[model samples]
Target: MRNPKKRGAAGNSNRAHGSSAPGVASENTDGGYNAGMAVFSYIIGGIIVWSLIGWGLDFLWGTRWIVLAGALLGAVGGFYLSHMHGLTSSRKNTGDRPAAGGPSQDGGTNAK
Candidate 1:
């Protein structure tokens, strides 16, 4: 009788497998996680930078409400940037199969 193979350490990596291991599962090089983190960083960075700018402006102008406006602007801009750069492409590549607006796929859009 032959024994079945078992999965260990969750998955494999380029360093472990030595070179690009296509079709293999791995966590060290997860594109989704990386994209998510990048989007999150954009949001947080926007907030921090804009808030600081607002603070400086407020200090120069002796106003108190500009900081709030700056924060809100930052959040909106961040969302826009993330959606424009990181998410749209990911949306198209949602699964292992080809995306929409393309031929040679098994099916079309799913009902929501």
Candidate 2:
């Protein structure tokens, strides 16, 4: 025979699984913030790499402005590329839901 207290505890645990549990909040902690960080890191990394390459080329060619120009262009391009890629990837990951007349896992229309 089970102890009365143990049986009560088990019953309470089962009740917790029901949908009406209080103090439950549904929210995603990981989302666009991570994507933004990834883009920033990519841009900074590209800028550093290009700057180094520019410095090396400048040293070899004895032209300082060439290195500066290359670094500037690389930084701008890297930022744009990273931003575009990050936006596209985020959308692809989250926006591929079915359209109208498609079956949804949640048994609801995909209209949004």
> Candidate 2: where is the Cα deviation over 4 Å?
1-30, 88-112
lDDT of 2 by residue, 30-107 (tens): 446655766677767777888888899899989888667767877787778876765435434356664557466776
Best by TM-score: 1
Write down the TM-score for model 2. Answer: 0.47
Error of 2 at 55 (Å): 0.4
TM-score of 1: 0.55
**TM-score of every candidate:** 0.55, 0.47
Model 2 RMSD in angstroms: 13.1
Q: Residue 66 of candidate 2: its Cα lDDT?
A: 66
> Native-vs-model 1 lDDT?
0.73
The C-alpha stretches of model 1 lying farther than 4 A from their native spots are 1-30, 88-90, 93-112
Error in Å for residue 20 of model 1:
12
Candidate 2 structure lDDT: 0.66
Q: For each candidate, what is the lDDT?
A: 0.73, 0.66
Worst 10 residues of 1 by lDDT: 10-19
Candidate 1's residue-wise lDDT over 6-89, tens digit each?
544544432455345554335555567657777788889999999999999999999998988899999888889998875536
